[model samples]
Target chain A: MIKTFLQHELKAFWRARNTGKNVAVKIIMGVFILYLLLCALSAGFFLDKILEHAFPGQNIVIAFCGIILIYFIFDLISRMQLQELPTLKVQPYLQLPVKRNALAGYLAATSIISTFNIIPFILFVPFIIKVIAVGSGAGVAWAFVGSVFGITIFNNYLALYIKRKANLNGWIFLIATGILVLICLGDFLWHIYSIKDISYLFFGHLISLPALVLLPFLLAVGMFYLNFLYLKDNLYLEELNSKKASHKSSTEYPFLNRFGTTGDLAANEIKLILRNKRPNSAIKMSVLFLFYGLIFYNKPAMMHTDYPVVFVGMFMTGIFIINYGQFMFSWQAAHFDGLLVNKIKFNDFLKAKYLLFTLVSTLAFILTIPYVYFGWRVLIIHFVMYLWNLGVNTTIILYFANRNSRRIDLSKGAAFNWEGVGGTQWLISLPLFITPILVYLPFSLLHYRDLGLAVLGAAGLVMILIRSTLINKLEADFYKRKYTIAEGFRNK
Target chain B: MITISNLKKIYNNVLVVNVPQLEIAKGESVGLVGNNGAGKTTLFRMILDLIRPESGEVISNGEAVAGHENWKNYTASYLDEGFLIDYLTPEEYFYFIGGLHQQTQAHVDDFLSTLTDFFNGEILKKGKYIRDLSKGNQSKVGIASCLLQKPELLMLDEPFANIDPSTQIRLKNMLKSINKQHGVTTLISSHDLSHITDVCDRILLMEKGRIIKDIATNSSTLAELEDYFAVGQSVISSLQIDEEENH
Candidate 1:
């Protein structure tokens, strides 16, 4: 039965409309995984040496045990974001003569075959062999490895269960992430608890008593059974229906009504972004990236430099447009036909896009204003970049939007989604990052850095004033290619 | 209401829609009938300017449809589920379409109140996005939005294919009333011959991307269409029997 399922999955993949693109993505992802495994392997090999160097006088075994809990906490959080739930395509088989328990067992078993489950071994096995085997004897070392493996399995099933629960209630996912963040901050920043002490207390004791390792194995088995039971109970087609008549009230912004049709259009787009998964992830990513200034700012080397400041400023202020605008019109690929045939003017539609970009970039700029503590220069650069994004990047992204015709399945998760992305996106992003630097480089080289910033602002101002003309040209370009774009979207 | 001249669309070197010249008059209700791959929807797409033709143009009310915005002001069409923003609830979709036509929210509410019977109490206040509705209910929503536009030129493709029997009758009446009372020009395509004859004044039969028969709707129109399709079906079934005997 499992073999049949595998064959069906393979055929389905190969017969998909975008098989070539899917294959390319898989190969790229394979190489990336290989690179990550190599990093973990090397980290494993020298972990004992690194631990000894960091804690010169402390016992190396205790120190290693202290880091174990910290590692698992971070592991669980990363897993929540990156781990994909193993799909049980049981709908078709429900009418067949297959046993229900067999399907549930298959799903629970396949969920273990993840890189997240393998990375811990690659990261810890070498240290166990090199240091623990030499000192703690073979039986104790083996027991240590066993306990760690057991805990790894436990974390795997726990994370999967939480993610499955998150699917039914979105707040569960948010609350899980929030609790993890709070735990990290509590131990590291607030100093309210000593996770390291607790880790040493538990793992250190495990090293001394090999027989106690069964506790972890039992815990692992308990979690696996929990998952199996959950799957068995909820495997019914009716129970599995995720679209259970969503009772969410329709959200409207009455203030937006003042802007007339353009506002209404923009408000509609806002709902599209908020209510869908992929676009919602884009917004979440933009919000998360706003914290990137913390990593770049206040560094003595970066503070004195002009180019780094400009680059960081550009990234911070324009991240939303950069992230979301690359797939502008394609976001509405499902309804592109309706949009074209409706009573909407291309100019007004384009105006709505501009309105959305300006509003979002302005909000992003305001969020970056607290970086003023870093220096006045930082604020000035961010404001200038914000202006450049509004006038320049918005137009460039919209221009490239005409070239992207691939339909995006808006409900799909955005972790590694490559939908609607093509060579045009990569080519267009280069200019967005480089244009600001190019404008600033010559002025900085000529020892007139202040004048360079003024020039950037002036260019943006000019573009802003002539935006209507730019929109007109874009509308003409859209008219010429609208058929091709619509055809590409329709094929899906 | 619409004129097609030398219009052709080819996919993979196969001409899917090749109408050289066709005219639809104002205030006329026309029904297009064809089997699968008969280019009914493709022709409707060309008329809406959703897909460009390989040659010539579609003229709506004396203006070319391509690169023109004037026709959209008075044209409303629903060819498939692609015509819907599936994320929006039915009411939100109706209001959005209504808002685009400069109708106030209260006006949209009044129009929706009139559709309560046609909707059959399954669409309004259902708390489901258009994507979640059953196929038949989704068709009802799409047709309702088209009517809400009060368009001069309304086009629908396979509108009756997914709708229920009672709703089909209701829709037939609605189309007829809209055409007679409002002088709206409507072009509807369907595989159901009886319903098409009941709703349309004129019938067009298409085959292999070409219009082979154009007839005024009369008592004999439904029987003629059925006779033509029955002959094709008999040929297919006999070919299968011959192959089975050979095997």
Candidate 2:
């Protein structure tokens, strides 16, 4: 029965797409898996070489363990955003007499085969072949592999447990990260309390080789057991029905209500964005970028050149426009059929998207104001880039909204995601970033910092003001191409 | 029960649903038939106030349905998956439909008891969500939901397209009882001509957004009905007048 279930699942998953989409996805994942493997091998080789200088006998195990822990953390964090159960295809199994524990086990085992798990094996296997297994004793090499595999299992299972159990906030990830950081900086923190020596006594001590292998295995087993229990207990009632999908109780967003009908519509659109994961994540991610400058900008000496701020600022704004704008139509993909069918006043709908785009990018622009707090010149250039991003980059993005064929997972969280992807999305960034630089770079170089700012700002303001003109032309154009957009959005 | 005036939808100077002013009275079962893209679904959506016509008014009991989104609570409609909430179990789906119609769980319970073999204890289980169900099971759930409500205006689009023969008979019987017992004004659309004839008091034949012929089941003989739809026109078929009257 289990074999039949698995067979049915594979057939359905493949059959959900056309041959082309399935082939393309398989090829992409294959290339990605290979790339990860190569990266892992190099890191392992480098780590082993470094530790060999300090503690030759225990070097391979120490290097391998360190690599395993960092990779485990990375995998666990990624897992939080992933659905343990695939959603689109899972609906067909509901009426069957399939047991919940069996379903849960399938999800758990699938979690182990992740790309993150594959990467470490790719990197370490070669290093073991070239260095550890060749040069180190048999017991030493065997112990090293055992401990690394155990740690990988530990990371994979812990992530599965937390992801399956928790309310799944991004902060849970930050808290996990903070604990690891404290561990790394344990000497400094321990010294803060005058226990630096004791910290060294425990941390610096040499534990038996067997203890390292034993610890991760124990943790992995414990987490897997906890996951099984969670499945057994909570496997009864299905999650909330789509009709009653919980949301922040509808609030009177009078802020957007001032645009009259447009405002009211825009306010409702904003409410939709706030209620959904992908759009809301856009807001969350942009706010998080505000701190990226502060995180790495702690050292004044490393800032010998102004490259860091400029790169960070450019990258930050670029990230927002690229990530948020890429899914321009997909955020509304589900309801576009209804919108097109209804007497929605089409212009208002487009206006609502523009309103949303401007609102979010403006919020991002405002958050980046502290970049000026670095220095007046850094501030001016950063402001110019931001204004350019709003004016030119955003408009270009909305224009490509016509052509963007990226499939957005409307169900996934917006913060740090993998939902929207396609070759077109990667290509969109070139124009969004380059156009702004071309317009402003020459003017700034000619001793016109303030002038460039005014021009960029005006251009953005003009785009916002004249959005109606473009949308009018676009509406006519889209009517002719409605069939194409519909086919593309549906991936038919 | 329903009245429509100048019901026309124009997209880029092309008429999509050029339904002239028509009235469907209370206690009538209507089968709205059309070929692919003949505007049957469009006309239904507009009548239900799901979409607006370019220039028309649809009134239910003198209340303009266009301004009322809550018309469906009284007039049950299942168009595509628009009505099905994927996350709910069949029981929950039944409960929701029942709730909107102001019916209690006991009403649903009593209804289910009549078809205990068909339901097979699935209704009592709250764990299984609707999305996990098969297409045939989902349709059964949907059909079961509408009947549970005991609606005044029951609208279903191709409700029997994928269901098993056994379940289909169960549905046909259930709908026949509700229509006769409550005098429910029903509008059902299907490609199946036989089923439509079995149930509908009035069957409309549509082509290219126009109702070419409207046949009253009481008036027309099955031979005459078959003759009207024959591939080529004959002398006698074209000669018939006052065609909507009794057999």
**Best-fitting candidate, measured by DockQ?**
1
Q: Report residue A183 deviation for candidate 2 (angstroms).
A: 5.8
- Where is model 2 more than 4 Å wrong at Cα? A17-22, A43-91, A125-136, A165-208, A240-250, A301-311, A314-324, A404-466, A487-492, B1-31, B34-39, B42-203, B206-213, B216-247
Instruction: Count backbone clashes in candidate 1.
Output: 0
The DockQ values of the predictions, listed in order, are 0.48, 0.05
Question: Candidate 1 recovers what fraction of true contacts?
Answer: 0.69
Residue pairs with backbone atoms closer than 3 Å in model 2 (clashes)? A40-A123, A41-A123, A91-B131, A91-B132, A94-B132, A391-A460, B219-B245, B219-B246, B219-B247
For model 1, give the TM-score of chain B. 0.94
Per-residue lDDT of candidate 1, residues A74-115 (tens digit):
999988877777754566787799888888888888889888
| Local error of candidate 1 at residue B44 (angstroms) | 1.7
Query: For each candidate, what is the lDDT?
Result: 0.84, 0.60
Please give the range of 10 consecutive residues that has the lowest summed lDDT in model 2 chain A. A199-208
Tell me each candidate's TM-score: 0.85, 0.62
